[model samples]
Target chain A: MKRGVFKRSLDSLESIFLFTSEFVRENHVDPSLLPAIDLIVEELFTNMVEHSSASTADVPMEMSTVDGGVEVTLTDEDADPFDITKVPEVDVERAVEELDPGGLGLHLVRKFADSVEYHYQFSNRQARIVFRKTAGSGGDDV
Target chain B: MFDLERREAGEVVLKGRFDAAQREKAQALFDEIHESVTLDCSELDYISSAGLGVLLKTQKRLLAEGGRLKLIGVNSHLRDVFKYSGFDRIFEIEPG
Candidate 1:
């Protein structure tokens, strides 16, 4: 497959994760791992949808499901230079402590993914996160 | 939005996603239950760290009111979230 392509407004984050989750479950990625995957995808997708700049804001998120695992690559040509890796650690106690309602998405991605890579080249930003079903190969089974 | 209802037996069952979008309402709805409440998590499809925070907050709120909170129909996914966050031990969980 050429991988699934998702292109929509910033408001589509919830549906994006919901749709991707079905694809993950269909791939036999393990029913046990769905929550972690779901959370990570929700967090990541929400970030890409909401945080990206308005100029190239119409960017599309591409997802590929291969033999080994699922790979989500969020691509935005006109997005700002900030890296999703910058999403800080949250004190879970104060996750919503009126402090701020942002940055938790990247934390979820790191916490759940086996490997998270952010590649910014030629003013094009792509955050590719890979989650492996089998543990110890660099990813947690969760 | 989740539609909530009360019982004469002093129990409350929440039906729907207990996620970020619903946490605020869930809290307000939870506050009205003046007695022990058992949340039916079967209809709850997903929850996030924010939602989990709401649960913890509710637990503290209920305990302070001399009331208890229990969760029912917790699937593996939700259970994982609870376990990962250590809320599994915090909530009075009952298997479906």
Candidate 2:
């Protein structure tokens, strides 16, 4: 497993992408999986940076290879109990005139990732979100 | 490494990764358009929901004015993103 920490800012996305790219390269993960991995990570990481409040600590990320895919975990320290898995589904069928962008990021996360799990630690006020993307999994078109 | 350029013919070209960090730059460019336009994404490598939001906002605005955003040169990976998000139905997309 490889681990890194990024500051709680939008600019950290570039660094996070670099970290993800390096990890995937070193691990020899399927090239076809890069898009899903990138999208899922970006959505989840940006969600934390944008929504998590009262936290100055950096977010920790871990990446590792699983059976036929990669697994990533991001922990937001000093954050409230915001269960991402329970977020309401987005009404994607809304017409263009009524379409709202809210919750779309997490909606994409759920769609692209093979599995998404969320856990919160009350004592430390930590929100840990882990997602896995496997080759030939999730989005049929992908 | 994201770039957006508006051509003389009014087509906007997009390149590189369009994540949350590039949203403002993309929005600024989209704000300049008032008519139906085609976004040439031939060189675009990736787009997250943030980028999608920018396109969605622009599409909504243009649709309100009886105009729409047409996307062309989308790669397979991006096609999946659009397909899963139901954006394929929202916009006219031409696969690269």
CA-based DockQ, model 2: 0.72
Task: Report the Cα lDDT for candidate 1.
Answer: 0.59
lDDT of 2 at A32: 79
Interface RMSD for each candidate model?
4.9, 1.6
**Per-residue lDDT of A1-142 in model 2, one digit per residue for the tens?**
9999999988998999899889889999886788789899889888888887578889999999998889999999999888999999998887877887788889988988989999999998988999999887875353
Whole-model lDDT values for every prediction: 0.59, 0.89
Query: Best by lDDT, which number?
Result: 2
Prediction 1 TM-score vs. true: 0.67
- Weakest 10 consecutive residues, lDDT, candidate 1 chain A? A133-142
For candidate 2, what is the interface RMSD? 1.6
lDDT of candidate 1 over A1-142, digit per residue (tens)? 2244555353454566666677766766644555666676666655555566464444455555655566666565565666666666765454322323245445555656766777666535443444333333222332
